[model samples]
Target: MCKAFEEWQEECIQKGEIIGALKTYKKCSFAKEETLKNIITDFSLSEEDAQNCMEKYW
Candidate 1:
């Protein structure tokens, strides 16, 4: 599920759907530590930024 969300998020970004991607992330249920770490690395986000994203969403 995490992998699927990550791929969907990337696809949304590529299609110029930033809001959609964020909304999807906000709805994610499998965002565990490893998943969050992967998200941070995949998006080149800072740890603080990733944490903030998780906090805002989950």
Candidate 2:
């Protein structure tokens, strides 16, 4: 929980690296669409989150 929060914060603050963060998150062994949904839901993010993140960072 601590680690997840920390990573989320990093992704939020480090806008230029959000795509890398998302890719890393997606590639994690623990990743799943449901988990991703939960993360986005918990953060109140949307598909724009991924798109904007990629556009800004990648």
Candidate 3:
């Protein structure tokens, strides 16, 4: 069986971290740009990866 990203919930897993960050942004008042910046900085994700993560998770 193939497990999905949503099924793998933990900060150690990059997928989970991205989901958590996006969910947190939705609840918080932080701006999108700031959130993206933080995601990139915190995860060391590339600009394109960060944007894609935002699109999928946000």
Model 1, position 13: C-alpha lDDT score: 73
User: Which digits, one per residue and each the tens of the lDDT, describe model 2 over residues 1-58?
Assistant: 6999999888767553444556666677444555456446555678667455545533
lDDT of 3 by residue, 1-58 (tens): 3456555544358788688988998789788899999999999999999999899888
TM-score of each prediction: 0.47, 0.32, 0.74
- Candidate whose lDDT is highest: 3
Who wins the TM-score comparison? 3
Candidate 1's C-alpha lDDT?
Answer: 0.63
TM-score of 2: 0.32
Worst 10 residues of 2 by lDDT: 49-58
Model 1 TM-score on a 0 to 1 scale: 0.47
RMSD of each: 10.2, 8.5, 4.8
Across 1-58, the per-residue lDDT of candidate 1 in tens digits comes to 6999999987767434323445565567544576567657767778887677666554
By summed lDDT, the worst window of 10 consecutive residues in model 3 runs over 1-10
Error of 3 at 13 (Å): 1.4
